[model samples]
Target: MGPLDRIEELIAYVEAAKAVPMSRACRVDRGELIAMLEELQAELPADIRRSEVMLAERDKIISAGEKEAERIIAEGEGEHARLVSQHEITVSAEHEASRIIGEAREEAQRLRDEVDEYVDTTLANFEQFLQRAVSGVERGRDKMHALREIGTFNPPEQEESEEKPLPQF
Candidate 1:
């Protein structure tokens, strides 16, 4: 029998013993009780060793679980760091693109202003040249009318060699 069963049997035997007269005591066989106690003592060490082995096994399992948890935590940390780095790179790329776009816009504006100034200056120069040419033509007409009134004007035919070629643009 196991220690527990033996202990129960011992208790039953003690309870079933005859009561002593005029005393809160019972008559138990000393030898039987002693034998039962000795047997219990003999069984205790083996039970204790089994308990110790079981406790050691539980500790080992707990240690393994703790290691696994640490490994998983480390992996999570690595993944988090990688994601953070990737996010930073993406943000940096976006910032660089924005900077480049801003610079391009500024350059385009500057070029546009330069082109507008160039066109305005060219038009002003062309207008001045046309005004001067118109004035020259008016002066020549006045001289021709004065000559006709003085009776010295002649509508002479021009020779091909006398003709001036038009100016190239």
Candidate 2:
């Protein structure tokens, strides 16, 4: 078969020798096996050297592929980092915007509360003024009615009177 198949078969044969018990018909010569293994060792290196350039080129190709794989992985990692950073920046911007909006809503609510308080105070003041005006109008009407009954609304003449001093507390 192929060279690897032959090598495997040979290793099996060598291993099988250890399992078989020595008998009259199973005697093996160590000298022949050692001579064959020595001959194989001597020729194997020369055969391997014949293809040294091809092996070197194959190794170079494998090394280049490994480097390319590393480059691709690094690029993927960088891209992932960039996307993560961008996501963080977007989230930060959204947070800032939300904070500003919240602050504005709070300020608007506060202003609305102040306006409501002011309106309530102003309405109270107006109601008080209206009550005083109605009372004053009623007093004027009563005075007119009294004047009609007396048939006059005459005033007293001014007189020079001495002013009295009050006691201090």
Candidate 3:
């Protein structure tokens, strides 16, 4: 039995025993005292067994609930970790795309600078060629004037080089 019930049982036994004492103070019949003790002994074991069953049932329910709670907690933690991993992969992809775009832009700028340099060099070379052409025309004019003054200016009709005829000044 529980502690309180054990105490009560003990007290009852003490009372019955005291009553049965063939003493002057608390006199009681012997047969009645024997009956009381016998009844108490029989009832105590049943009471103790009932209390043990109740405790066992309570413990079983508590342990089952605890196992269910642990399963739910483990599932929630797994879901959280999966979401975090997916987010990290997404962020990494975005970072890589940004880096590649930046590199492409830098390469485009480098090519543009090279094109600008080439164009400037070509224009300078074309300008020098035009100046040389004008100088050659002036020299040809001076040669034609001297030949006319001497009355001895006769050019061969055909030239070996495949070129347009120089203008006679």
Give the top-scoring candidate (TM-score).
Answer: 1
Q: How high is the CA lDDT of each candidate model?
A: 0.57, 0.49, 0.49
* Poorly placed runs, candidate 3 (over 4 Å): 1-23, 88-169
* Tens digit of per-residue lDDT, candidate 2, span 104-162: 45654555566556555655665564455445445434533443544443458779788
What TM-score does each of the candidates earn? Answer: 0.41, 0.35, 0.36
lDDT winner between 1 and 2, please give it: 1
* Deviating ranges (above 4 Å) for candidate 1: 18-28, 88-169
Model 2: how far residue 33 lies from native, Å: 99
Looking at model 1, which ten-residue stretch has the lowest summed lDDT? 139-148
Report, for all candidates in order, the number of backbone clashes.
0, 0, 0
Model 2 stretches astray by more than 4 angstroms: 1-85, 150-169
lDDT of 1 by residue, 26-107 (tens): 5656677667667866875676575556556555655555565555555555555555567657665555545555554565
lDDT for model 3, on a 0 to 1 scale?
0.49
Residue 87 error for model 1, in Å? Answer: 3.5
